[model samples]
Target: MVKGVILRQFHSLILLLFMLDTFANSTDIQPLRQLRPRLVHLYNWAQRTPDYNVIWDLCCDHGLLGLHLHQATTAYGTHVHLVDQVEPIVDKLQTQYAHRQDGNLSICLTPAEHIRLAKQAKQLFIIAGVGGETVASIIQSILPAIQALPPSPHQQIDMLISPNKHVFSLRRALQAMPFTLIEEEFVSDKGRHHEHMFLRYQPAAPTPPSEVGDALWLPATQDKRIYIDKLIKHYGALSQYSPTAFNQQALAAYQALKHKLFGE
Candidate 1:
């Protein structure tokens, strides 16, 4: 009886604390409010710098990206745009943020059109889903728009992309462009595996082709290291033309990074 009473007391206390926190926080009116913690981490990291003004969420399903931003108290003033194709998806978006106008949310029905818009100093382009190739093309389109815009107050990344496949190809092309990585993440959300990265580039920090390489090694972070280790261990055994997540190039990228496994 005593243990049951104590457990009830603890639950009540936790509920009280949650209520207090909710009261302390102001709700940003968001239509499709779903919080993805990993993505929230991405936004919080980008917001650390004053110059990244725009946050673009492409291939956004149900506007969950906007939902996550709304939960963050510090992410206001950053123009958050959601992009996805299909009438049903946009229809759902309309149902969600119908009255929002204070720069908290904007809807883009055409992904390519928005990609071609001029990049701003505060712009932060995010393209997820699809393959690395599509992500690269969006970045390519955004570059022209970036050129048309007046010089931003500061030089930072123009895009952050998370492709479903062909990440190796994506990274290789990014190395060739004026993009610098801000953060990379490996997340398993609701049984789905995802690798997301945040990148920004300034024209001033032009990448020299001489320093460019054909392959990119995973950074020495614990998660990336573990990811590489897993891949390298599985590489040789993976059969060709297999319907699996890691492709031949991914296996190759893992092979290239095997040196990192031994602290080489």
Candidate 2:
């Protein structure tokens, strides 16, 4: 009886080890429990648009979002590049994920603006977890290099950006560029409001004010109202402090937006 019990225990231990190994090797890992909603929103958006040959996650801190994208689209030949300027973070990510069997991942220790792309590749650049001003600056810095590429019908590049603040300024900057807004969303996460947008460069097309996206006011939710109020206060302060024609115009626009959204 003793021998039989030991034998059964040994079998159970082996089974437990097998289950652990399977779990560790599984590709369908659940998202990190603490992932912010803005990142989650971006990941879902990437999954929805899976035709890109390469996905670049700029300023990718821990490479969580890029890794998630790799798992979701690797079977379809999508490669994920995680770019960050920090050396330690990049090295850590490289050590962790660079040895995967499928080999569709790259970790780049460089600024977002320095990363270049092949002219014939369909690329999606995800810029998140930063301020709007920084996001705009990165876009501006990279625009010249991207424009110099030889035009190809297959060379499609898209940017998905979620800026933490100064969204209106960012919107204006984007409008001034050759890019057109494809989609925009206002996401409230962890008591913070985030504005996310997908933009594609279309040099021949003009971007209208509608493309700048007033969608933040459409939902009529408390969060939306709060966001509007914040915008109003922000522009109000800007107009009061600077009192420039530009500031006044922006204030007028925000006031108009408030009136349209809340009838106040």
RMSD of each: 8.5, 3.3
Candidate 2 lDDT over 139-207, as tens digits, reads: 898888788889898998888999888776787787788887777888988899988888887788845
> Residues 114-186, candidate 1, lDDT per residue (tens digit)?
5544344466666766787888777776676666667655545555555766566677677677766555666
Steric clash count of candidate 2:
0
lDDT of each: 0.61, 0.81
**Ten-residue segment with the worst summed lDDT in candidate 1?**
208-217
**Cα deviation of 52, candidate 2, in Å:** 0.5
Considering every candidate listed, which one attains the maximal TM-score? 2
lDDT of 2: 0.81
Off by over 4 Å in 1: 1-34, 50-52, 70-76, 101-104, 114-120, 154-157, 188-193, 207-226, 229-250, 262-264
